[model samples]
Target: MQSANLQKQKLELIEKIIHTDDQNTLDFLKSILNDETSDYELTDEQKQIVEEATAKYYSGEEPSFTWDEVKNNIRKRNFQD
Candidate 1:
């Protein structure tokens, strides 16, 4: 997209946000704007899992699933009704 179009879309979004009366919507926007990576802390076990996953990803030692495959797998596992 062009920069001009991006700026126009942003302005439209800002206008919509300004006119929105829902407190939940406003709070969501505020949280999104204020959110930072530093706000999240991972436990030691979670960190170890992430490091292992990262290594496997970089080394191509594990297979990957497409979005469709992942969703289908989840449905098969969890939505057996």
Candidate 2:
């Protein structure tokens, strides 16, 4: 099928779906349209962080923290009555 025809079909289908399931269809459309491609551009710091994580994973040197360690840290932060 041609791209134009496909787009028209999609629009018609979306309209029908919206009419039948207004809230869900609106939410789906909102989610689809809310994506700001430009805003998702990664910063230099984020890029470096991703690179570091990738390097750690590839080098088999990723740091591992246990659940007990997390619980202990959180417990220490709590003040007992």
Considering every candidate listed, which one attains the maximal lDDT? 1
Stretches > 4 Å off in candidate 1: 1-3, 15-28, 31-38, 63-81
TM-score of 1: 0.46
Would you list the C-alpha lDDT of every candidate in the order shown? 0.89, 0.79
Best candidate, TM-score: 1
Model 1 weakest lDDT span, ten residues long: 31-40
| Per-residue accuracy of model 1 over 1-81 as CA lDDT, tens digit each | 579989999999999998999998987788889882335689999999999999998899998889999999999989786
Candidate 1 RMSD to the real structure: 5.3
lDDT of 2: 0.79
